[model samples]
Target: MPSKSSARHAALTVAVVCSAASTLVLTAPAHADSVRIHDIQGTTRTSPYAGQQVSGVPGIVTGVRTYGSSKGFWFQDPNPDKNPATSEGVFVFTSSAPKVAVGDSVTVTGTVSEYVPGGTSSGNQSVTEITKPTVTTVSTGNEVPAPTVIDSRSVPSRYTPAGDSAANGSVNALTLRPARYALDYYESLEGMNVQVKNVRVTTATDPYAELWATVKPSENRSERGGSLYGSYDSQNTGRIQIQSLGATADFPVANVGDTLSGATTGPLDYNQFGGYTLVASELGTLKSGGLKRETTKKQARDELAVATYNVENLDPSDTTFAAHASAIVNNLRSPDVVSLEEIQDNNGAKDDGTVAADVTVNKLIDAIVAAGGPRYQWRSIDPVNDQDGGEPGGNIRQVFLFNPERVSFTDRAGGDATTAVGVTTVRGKARLTASPGRIDPANAAWANSRKPLAGEFVFHGRTVFVIANHLNSKGGDQGLTAQYQPPTRSSETQRHAQATLVNTFVKSILTAQKNADVIALGDMNDFEFSGTAKVLEDGGALWSAIKSLPKNERYTYDYQGNQQVLDQILISPEIRRDRAFSYDSVHINSEFHDQISDHDPQVLRFRP
Candidate 1:
């Protein structure tokens, strides 16, 4: 992987490549006299010059990356080419930092290679690089090529071309169509200097000093100035990741809706994360949009307020307890019942055998009371150490927080992480055999993931079944900018099975009693329109409450310049039949740079 720095020299240039270290197979070098950078790039995702040797490739050094394991410098040919399908710039991969500086015109002889950023299995497009180069500086202080402007007119409305079926839906062999597809257009400008003026931020700056902005500000934009990923077919092409090539410390901290005023100049590059990224050498001024965090109105006197929030691996070592408590109290308005996900053990990521989270849970409860909120009580089962997949020894799980004044917990005995919970009939009414119990814990579907925790709660003498879940994440899924046209979501298989189990459990409860109130809510880690959600809503077992809001306001997470729905609250017919429920996806964290969590909390209010 590439290294990051906080300072830069007088020559302003951005390193566009975030390449992984790779080995090259040396062979006899061929003498190709008529080859240029564009000829090496060809017009496809893979270069036609791949595996072939070329000599006397001439270009001016535009950027020099002195750090990172894959130390290299990007050079651009100043000569003009009529075809827009081919890029004039390419990176020369040197084992160590190249002695060349920016504006140095040099001739290189090397073998053309395609390096995949995250390995071949990532499905990401390979980067065209000249590996094992012999560089000879012919002149110094030569002018670099002019940067191409990236605006709404340049990027296409279409995302990508249809992949070839013969290659398992891979677009790697497709010819470049710069004016038609967005991915192709970006590919045409790969490793070349580009600029975007007055771009609107779609995703906040993350810990890696990277942010995303949209060239087409009005294309499928949400009301809050963000691009919406409503479905697989609507992949917005205007969004592009922005990372600084100069000083990481000098990168602007931006939030969604903010503007990077003036021209942000950089070279267009492709990486493992976010597909097409602009590594900025010259940054623009940041103008705040004044995007404030949203607060939900207080629930009515007779209404039951239930919320789901992923605390993002909360433990005693975390310092965001006060801010999180304030968000729960003032921003969320203190829901009657709050389902918390990613509640880590007391030691956080320590690999100790301790699985109890009493210290972690108690600290948050105390902070909530200190923030002028209710005296909340939490209930959760400790999992076996190193079994649940998370931050190593974090042992992250779901926990329930209920306000004693507005709700009452019905605790049944013999509930553990390994034991499965089942529904039973008590006096002709549906009830859980073990309250605060795991749902199908031993099932293969939940192998390294958090099992659903079923809890029995009472609101004004009405029984409500709440299942908190933190399903397996979409870790192995291919990205939208992958070499495949429609990226494969390999991680969905486990989520589908997990959802099916939850749906089956809900169906079992409803079968025991016709009008049982059941609410399954948490970080589903899948989109609302995904197949996983379809399986959960199968046989009319439950309906996603997030659909109650407008399509533009349905997202509970912002990722990679797309406002999407990953966390949701699905309710049974007993809760959805009556149109008395009000749902709010409170926008507190996902849109802000200084966030306690990456997911926004969701609240559902209804009268039983």
Candidate 2:
């Protein structure tokens, strides 16, 4: 047996293999450059097959765990193992499936990966092999300890902005077919817990430069007047996310077929169109058992609880993601979870004579951190290719910004760190990503039905998520009102449809899962009390959060001189208790907009 190293490295992160760490041996007939990790916490490893199909070329699933589905796991191995470990760091396969019994070690063929961030801890890398290895039974492997995978499935589907996938079948490609919404039942589950597996998602393939993520939830009925549900719960219909696969980690797919093992910490939630889904939060797994505080118990401040704000269309140059992030980071009235719209999309642009998205977005993360934003990092959509045969401005739009120490998450496929909201798409899979003359025609079957841009995140230890967004603008001011007067323009029709879809989605979540803490916010492209506003309010959801506040404190964005109330922060029943309030509408990049874009911004204050 090769002595396994247990030296704990702390640079990067990677996925785990089984319960505890283990010692692994690679049998290669040729001299191959390999890495070995030693003293990995306490895990051990060993090679089951010496040299057959795996040929020591670094491939195969060495272990398996049952979380909920038969998914794969990889131990982030940086260097090859040559010695013994002080502790153990076995790759863990969570609880759910057939189950990995004590002394159960299987030798298979696949690619072993350097521990990845989505893995155990830092200084690690993860491997998602192209080919899966065959599970060859071996001597009963050492029984390694298991870590907890606290579930977050019931956090409500309302927070998943316009691109998360589900099994509800509400949408057919980019378009949605109509039926009895069952909208009333979808409300109560807003903050509950559920699981979504194997979700294949899509997003707006718009080849634009604006840092935007426009989402639409449902369709058909609410097409008349816009609604907040569509905007807030846009991605709940199980569609495409520029960056994510669907519903966090494709749980529905995992749930339906075979799976490892997984559970829920919050209430379980499901949709008519989708199966089960939940918000992402700190895992209860790998319990350090050291003075840890549960986020679910985060207290609400007495003066002003932290509120959520969605700054509409806040695109600045790539150089300002971090430093400029602080400009909006510290809200005047203050908020715990500040939901921003139109962050900064980095797809493809000639920055210093080099095509770069990470170059700019990375700077944003650095700047925000330097500004003392605290452990705040970012995730993005790594667009397949945004080169010409492209749109004018490097086709990129995303939503990202978080207090690192305050939240934890896993990244899916996307562009840059900030613009990960919009991934490389084959077509306009969203609210029109690849429009005409841009990157060729795209998949816009659900063009007008874009869901809100969102992710499963945690706030103050509480398992909460945000659906940040901005919808189609009121294209032009005129020609809207042949049937309806003000707020109606030809260009605004699609924009209004965006509103209707959002409204229905939000209402559905609130109806399905009551007693949920949800916030449906962003630029509705219209004013309050108008079509979009009325529908959201009539849905009984507004009664919980924002409506719970005094009227004067509701508006987030202001107009020229009059208070048109274009931006807002709507909430659900569970979150209404936070006593949320409006901070102030803003113009973070006044100089830029003065130089480029249009829309202003909105800011809100929170107290949790």
Candidate 3:
């Protein structure tokens, strides 16, 4: 974990419990005379010697992190205690480059502290550290601690035990049962040198010079060699993050199905991003698994293909326009109507009150034409300046790209960002009052989020309603390694509200005309099994089409090590009752390091 800032350390003058189950223990003496590493790192999440001084702590340096904001050297005690719960290693925070090398026997005297990354507001567990240290090298050329093998046998199949119910579901106070739970097993060896051999890469190498691999290759493994995250209960415990302690340029690039051949030795450190990360002093050799991107079949003559792609805050200045265009044209097989999310304004985050995305959309259309695809016409409403919650001044909103030759846009006038779209009966058919209109944009659910863009289109002379949405993100949700068991997801409130509003709008359309063909699709930003999806599917208004795919193949986004679904396409009963439609989550981007966007695009093909 990163070193606790001076401000945070100063603010934490007294012992502060990291979890509800943690309490300040004054049972130990005021100051430890000769404290071992395991003595300082007790059996719980918080050290018993926290906020107390320890002198002459002896250990051999296992790894030295010379870069980043949190520069420190990890050392492990040569002799371990009888109990397996207490860790025999600890991180000595130096605030800068540490003047230590691996295999150097050193004696450290410092204050034992628990440094919580991302502050206490983030529900992350703290990393035990010794801050403001005075280091003395006792000897040189001493051997480092023998690396512990973290294979399938070491990591338990069970992820975690139930937290103490009285302590707000916090497992901090619970004793570490290393053999029983995977989380406890990792926590027991925190800051200790560990090794993994012949591990399969679960997530591709990211821009941050990091990758994820799993010790247990078969645990919820996807067909494409990724660990699938199907539900909240099944967080794959064998997956772990790996980062190099060397230069970023020296780090090897890898894909999802790649393998880390040979032993990769590292100190297991806890961080804010991925909970337990191995900062590898010795990186494994990257062996390609030959994983290739997938392509979906082109829509047939009678089928109307509708696709959704989140262009990851696309703007005029981005060089990824060509790649994104290729993905839509080649990978997605050129869908008839594509819902594009995160299309930035013309100025592209310049903050000059420019919210129009005509330049952006037209540029993409031109690129699509250049890529030998159909000339797609676009329709979208410019959101209020800085009102939509994305990159500040970017004004990210959803746009529709329709093949004019295959589909005709129903352009009813007078639709703006704040105007609410309603359904009305026109010649015994359901018609949107404003074609390409916002769905309750003024509602509190869309306060700082992208308002759902509802559009009316005529596909092969049949009227179809498509509502494109990019709901509130899961920015503040607690991670799987949070201090509390079943961490809180405060961001779901807004998404649930937004889903309810969209569901009501769909019901209104169906109420106007019973068998109206309606398809609501975009970056839902929630899983298929989430409460938000349930709300959208409530009252039988719509059903998520992605559910048709088998559980292992239902992912559109890859996070850390788990392949999960954050984007969805929901269809009305009239369209889904027959089960004749086809859905494809084209995995062109998420599992590759050369991705233009982080999320893979999804396509739905049906006759409307």
RMSD of each: 3.9, 26.1, 4.1
- What digit string (tens of lDDT, one per residue) describes model 1 on residues 1-608? 00111211110122233333432222344556669999988898888787778889999988877665657888988995899999998988896989998899999998888887776776878888898899999999988888999999999999899899999999988999999999999999998988999999999998778999999999888878888899898888999999987789999999999999999986777777777889888888999999999999999999999999999889898899999999999999999999999999989878878899999999999999999999999889899887777777789999999999999999999799899999999899999989989998999999888889999999999999999999899877898998887889999999999999999999999999989899999999988898989999999999999998998898988988999999999999988996489999999999999999989999999998
* Clash count per candidate: 0, 204, 0
RMSD of 3: 4.1
TM-score of decoy 1: 0.95
- Candidate 3 lDDT at 279 equals 85
lDDT of 3 at 559: 90
Candidate 2, TM-score vs. the true structure?
A: 0.38
Write the residue-wise lDDT of candidate 3 on 466-552 in tens digits: 999999998888889988887889999999999999999999999999999999999999999999999999999999999999888
TM-scores vs. true structure, each candidate: 0.95, 0.38, 0.95
lDDT of 3: 0.88
Q: Clash pairs of candidate 1?
A: none
Candidate 3: residue 516 lDDT (0-100): 93
Higher-lDDT candidate of 1 and 2: 1
Shift in Å, residue 572, candidate 2: 0.7
In order, candidate lDDTs are: 0.88, 0.32, 0.88
